[model samples]
Target: MCLRGKQRAGRVQSRVHVDTVDPLSAVSDGVYRLDREWRFTYVNAAAAALLARRVEDMVGQRALDCFPEVAGTVIEAEYRAVFADGRDRVFTYFHAPQGRWFEIRAFADPDGLTAFIRDVDDHHRSDQRRADRVAQLTAVLEALPQATVLLDGDGRIVSANRRWTETGEVIRDAGLRPGVIGDSYLEVLSQHLTAEDRRIIGAGIGGLVTGGPRAADPPFVHDYAHAMGSQRAYFRLQAARVEPSGQVVVTHTDITERVRDQQALAWRAAHDDLTELPNRARLLELVGEALGRDPGRGALLLLGLDGFKAVNDSLGHEVGDELLRQVGARLREQVRPCDVVGRLGGDQFLVLARGCDAAEAAALAFRLRTALTRPFCAEGIPVPLTASIGVAAAQPGGDGVHQLLSDADTAAAAAKGAGRDQVHVFSPGLREAARWRLEVANRLRDGAVDELVVHYQPLVRVDTGEPEGVEALLRWQHPERGLLSPAAFLSVAEETGQLIPITRWLLGETTRQAAEWAAGGLPLRMSVNISARHFSAETLVHDVRVALHDSGLAPENLVLELTETSVAEDPTRAEDQLSLLQNSGVVVAIDDFGTGWSSLAQLLALPIGTLKIDRSLLTAAARLAAGGSGSVLTAIVSLARTIGIRSVAEGVETPAHLQMVREAGCELAQGYLLARPMPAADVPRWASRVRAAGGDSCALALRGRAH
Candidate 1:
């Protein structure tokens, strides 16, 4: 059988040879033969069906006529080239009329061309979608802010953004090969990164690439520091796999600013703003760390500046601040090389001495105290300062940081109590005392004023032996313990700010009891001790007025007794308040006169109606009476007499005391010999009994002094 076509010259041409039944008819692909005239000479059954035409009708038809959409297209050009060159050509073409893609293979023969055609629409569309996705991914990668690179499953860079290019240039100068397309990202990183960083990065990215069944794995992230010349730069690397494609996208973001900000915040949190020393929180942490290593090897020195409050009050706070700074500097310089000096807030400093025992700590504390006592010049003036130092050697099996601080603080309190410019080592007794103080302060703060009761001690005239006034003393009836004297808790109250309320309560109670006594024909003047804190509060006058008004007691029947030290604390304020009270007919007496550092001039300048000589002076005067050297007591009493101010001799416990005050012309005296401090209910009966006994209790006690 033969296939023939008409040439342009109108002559018959043999295109292909075929079997009688056309063996190409069973092939799945469409097979056809065309002549040089571009006419179809033979079409198999598949070709006829693919062209949607009958083979008998299409056999002699021209291809352009059957499918004119192929004209002026690459399919037509390739077909013509195959014919001219006599070469075989394979190409894919879209037939617009059928809206389908087909792959065509044309073989040029001497006479004509035989073509094989297969439907390839699915393959073409799939390839087009993949190309579009790659283009979109490239666009997204270019738009990223951080340096980014895309890696194929083989760990080779497939694409990178502009930022990655810039970063690569920097890395190239650091003796590393920059990552480019087809380069391994890990290989480039391994050049400059540490071994650990390389291991971490490799594991992270590798896991994502070959994750297989674990395709939902979280993205890998790491932070690293890189040396860029003289300075350092920090970066966070993040890598995530592209799903279904097994490709990984890696990003390097700079985090240097964030890291530096965090560091600054941490520093400020731990350091003091004024002195740049470790604050309380940081000091506790340091102590804890030291104790963690060797709990019994170290010691803590707590130094509190003595008379700091006086300096702050007398001079301006500016000068005081300068003094504190100097003190901190001195402490820092005085400590050992291994010691850490830190500020524990205002006017207090702490020294951490490593590997020191109690003896060594005490020695260091003495040195610190010596250094602190030296005069500091503030604002071109020499200001004297001193410190009370406490030494607490770290003990094994203790409560650690807080316990150490507490022990040191207790020791410091003991030193201050002993005297300024002193050092005290911690002891178990101090701990017990500290616990008692804490209990007292806590109870006082928790409304313990109700447990307070007043006891009255008579102040009698040394000349007439008649009762003149009663001094009110405070006593605490503890729930657990027995009645407590003011000596046990008054100092703690003053330190804890519980003194003012206690004083106010005392005033009301004493005034009310005095009014009751006066109503019962015993009209004794009430004397209540006032604190310096009251002068500072400026509510002393108002509190006194309220007490007197509430109790219906005459102002003349109330006496306010203040220690000379309390008055000297703020002399101007004390004078102002005391002058007003004196004008109101309330007697103002300076209690504990000789015990304070106040000069006689300051004492005499105040509007004092009476001076209660301190017990120590009376004891000294009695000891020196036989030697005719009791001039100090006689001088004080004579001065009071000349100034028209009454005198009361305190601690008149012996007949000698009573005789001395009487010969010294003391106006009044009170002691255990005459009558001890009694309850409020016992005061009226006692006063009446003293009045019935010839109104001379002092003389009666003197006459019966031997018993």
Candidate 2:
């Protein structure tokens, strides 16, 4: 075939002469030929179909004239380049008017160029969909808050988001390589990681990328800390396999703030807010650690501040708090470098001395006690304080931290009981006593108050020898140990906070009994002992009112007796509650008046209706009366009478005792000399018998002395 070109209207045109049967016409793919002038010289049937044009009409046409949109486009450029270089060109193009994609290959000959085209619309659309998906994925990665990177099946970094790039820049100065496209991700990780970290990260990421045995498992995660310049940062790395493609999507989330917050929380949890010392929980933890190291070679010193309540009450709680802080500081100063001091809450502290024996612990305890004895100044006021320290040296095969603390606490209790400002070492006896106290406290908490019964000892009018009133005494009807006295459990009850409930029950039971007696024509005044704990609870007045209202007992007929120590513990609360009760017509009495350290002025300040002379004072007076000097007892009675308070002499066990009280002008007398304490059921029988014998029970007893 021969081809010629003609110039027309500044464009090149071509003419071609072909044989009757053209070889190019038989091709299935569309075929066309362009001459050196860039004009179509021939078009086949397939080319006609792909180009959607007639061969006859396109034969003499310029390529740009036939497809005008190809002007100044990639198709025109490719054809020109083929003609110039006489080389083959292959490209894909879209025929906009035909609305189809086609793959074309052009070959340049000396005289002209021949082109082959094929319809590729479906293939092109699929490839376009994949590209769109890749673009969408890139957008998603860019929008994520965490630093993210995508890796190929070979573990090569394919793409990374802006955050990843920024983080890489930030960590580059810390000897880490910045993640770059097409770089091996594991290689980049190895730049800064230790051998161990490198191995772990490589295995985790490599398994996901290479579809190893662990690929089917959940995402791999790791947490690490990095120092960025002067600040430390924490990051959690997460690597997840992208299904089917064997690609991995790795993410790093910064958790520095969360880590800092957690650390702060841990610190606060382990330390006391006020004293800045390890608190109870953390102290126990440290003690446990110490014991774990050497269970038989350590000791714990438990210190309880003696009379701290009085200090807190006398001064304000602000000053008390300052005192506690100073006390903690002093304890820290006194402890050895290897030892630990911690607060066990209010007015209590503990020292953990590892490698200390019993003798060493006792010496340390004495030293600590001496240190506390030094005065402290709180809120500009000088305050003297002392600690009762209990030493518990670890025994071979001793129990753990809790048992050690318990032992030390028991010893401290013994020390305090012995007196304030004393040091005591723990022994087996103290453990037994502590166990008994614990058992008693537990039982009292578990409704053992119901096992209690009241017994009344009659108080008689000294002049008439007639029963006028009775003092209620508590007796525990123990299922295991017969009847027990108050001395056996009352102290434990007070310590365990069970005393308030016991007092509540006492009020109810005593008031009900007193009302019943009055209803039965006995008409005897009832007395109940109140505890200091009730004052602390601020519930004494309410408790009394409830009892009186529930039992229909006249308030005037019920007397509430308090010890001097009970009133002194929290005197403001006592005064407030007592004033309210006295206003409500309930009589108040100070029981065992001579035994406590209450001053006469302190006594006169209260709304007193009577003073019950303690047995000690009465006995001392009787002995002195035999020597012709009963001045103290006589003065007490005269003072009570002067203040309009009736005086009752307790423990009048002899005829001489009764005579001594009578001569001293006491209005009432109650003792074993007349009658012992009897049950509520026996009180009526006893009263009836005394009345049947002409109502002179005391005279009947004294008739033997008179004879």
Candidate 3:
């Protein structure tokens, strides 16, 4: 087929001769043949489909004229050059008008030029997808908190994040600046890491790049601490192997705070918060360690402070805390360098002296007592202090820390009993004393009500010698021993918390006996001693009302006497309690009034009806009365009178004592002379006999003033 183009009206015209072999019509790829004039002489089916046109209409048309978009473009220029040099040209071009990529080959033929075209759009899209994937991965690495480094399979640094660049400069002084691309990271980092860190990191990196048997597990981690700027920082390095590509990625993260928190927790576990000394657990641990090292060369000393509770109650807990801190400091100063001082608890301390014998421990204890005896004046308040120290020598592989501490505690109790501010060595007798105390505490808890009884001591009128009232005293009838006084077992009862129930039983029993006496025509006022523990009880008012209701006794007939110390504890709270009792018609008396540090303001604030002079004060007043002074007693009585309270003098055994009470203007007297405390059963008979013999008034009330 021959196609010719003729010029007509400045436009190209084309003619075709369909006599030649049509080679372009047999191919699957697109085909079109154009003469020198650029007219289409033949167009195959594929080319027609590619151009979306008819073969008959394109056969005589000019190729550039048929598609004006490619008239002056590179695609058209290359096609013209193929006809000019008679050279075969192959090229790929994007047809923007059709939005497709085309690969074409132009061959110079004897009849005309032929061009072959194929669509290459899929290959172009695959290359664009690969570039997009690379950009996405780069963005993710840049946003991470940890400084990250990526290495190739050959162990050379291939890429790094922005954080890696910043950290590399900061840590460069430590010889760890290996962030540049195409550098050996392992070689650069070897100078900074220790031999052990080097080994761990080397194994991890080798496992990643060499693709060993660590493909299933997670990344390897390494931790180290380094000083950065002014503070030390901790970091963890994690080396992971990327999947499909045997490359290594290392990340560094700071963990300084986590490490510091762990250290602080460990320190707090072994120390006391108040004194900053080693606590009981830590002290025992240290003592056991010392004993283990030298079995017979160590001694333990335990100190119990006297009157610490009074300071805590009177001043304040804040002042009490400051006192304890000062005490700890003083203890540290008194001990040797090898010794350890620690607070066991409130008002109790323990010292473990290494290389010390009993004598040395005793000496140290004495020195400590002397040091503590000086008034602690912290917080600007002078507080007198004393310590009872107990020393126990190590038994050379015989006893543990617990036994040693327990023995020391027993000896300390003995020291306190012998009047505190002294030191005592552990002895066999102290153990027996401790055991007896334990037994007493247990028995008191079990059978306090059944084994205990109240005895009545009559209080007589100082003028007429008439029996006006009786004071109830607690006596324990032990099954083994004879009757026991309060001084024998009351301390143990209070220490073991058994005094509360015991006091309740006493109140109920005394009220019942007083009601019985009144029913039998022997009416007298009943005075019961109440402890500070009972007086401070929230149920104190309720307990008293219950007792009176249950015993059928009038409130006015019962008198509750409290010690001066008990009344001084939390005076405001004590006033509230005392007011409740007084409003119920119960008389409140301050027993042993002059023995405590009660201020005049405190005494006036408390709602009280009577004041009982202690035996010591009365004895002193009696001796002074012999000299015709009697000023102290007169002042006390006059104060009582001014405050609308009656005065009662205790321990009036001698005629001189009786004479002094009458001279001092005291209203009542109680002593062995008036009536020794007797059983509740014997009180009635004693009162009846004294009344029948007309001696009750003569025995109790003075017939006339002492001359």
Backbone clash count for every predicted candidate, in the order shown: 0, 1, 6
Candidate 3 per-residue C-alpha lDDT over 1-707 given as tens digits, one digit per residue, 9 for 90 to 100 = 23334434322323333344556667889988888888876777788888877766687678877888897877888987887789999998888878988889999998669899887777866656644643555576688888877777898887788998887888776544545888887886665666887888788777778887765268788886655546677778888877655667788787788878977887788888899898899999999999899888888899999978988988999999999999999999989898999999999999999988889888888999999988988688899889999998888765698988899998888889888888999987887878888889888767756989889998888887778889999999988887999988888888888888888888899999999999998888999988888766666788889999999999999899999888787687778888999999999999997788889668867899989999999877767767887468988898888879999999877777877778878998898767789998888887876687575554533333232
lDDT of 3: 0.82
Candidate 3 lDDT for residue 660:
76
- Report the error of model 3 at residue 680, Å: 1.2
Off by over 4 Å in 1: 1-134, 174-177, 191-196, 309-325, 377-382, 628-630
Give the higher-TM-score candidate: 1 or 2: 1
- By the lDDT metric, which is better: model 2 or model 3? 2
| Number of the top lDDT candidate | 2
lDDT of 2 by residue, 1-707 (tens): 23334434332333334435577766799988887877777778788877887666677678878788988877888988887788899999988887889999999887699999999999998879766765776798999999999888889988889998988888887655687999998887666555777888888887888796668479999877766667788878899997665678899899999989998999999999889889999989998888888879989999999999889888989999999999999988988999999898999998998898999999989889889888999877899999988999998898888999999999999999997899999999999888888889989989899899999999999988999989999999999989999998999999888889888999999999999999999999999999888887889999999999999999999999999878876677788899999999999998998888878778878888989999999878777777987468999899889989999999988898888888899999999988899999999999998898889989876774567
> Which 10 consecutive positions of candidate 1 have the poorest summed lDDT?
9-18
Scored against the true structure, residue 266 in model 3 reaches a CA lDDT of: 74
Once superposed on the true structure, which residue ranges of model 2 sit more than 4 Å away at CA? 1-199, 214-217, 227-231, 241-249, 296-326, 342-351, 355-368, 374-449, 460-468, 492-525, 533-559, 570-587, 619-631, 654-667, 684-707
Model 3 per-residue lDDT at 339: 92
Would you list the clashing residue pairs of candidate 3?
Answer: 1-20, 464-701, 465-700, 465-701, 465-702, 466-701
User: CA lDDT of 201 in candidate 2?
Assistant: 87
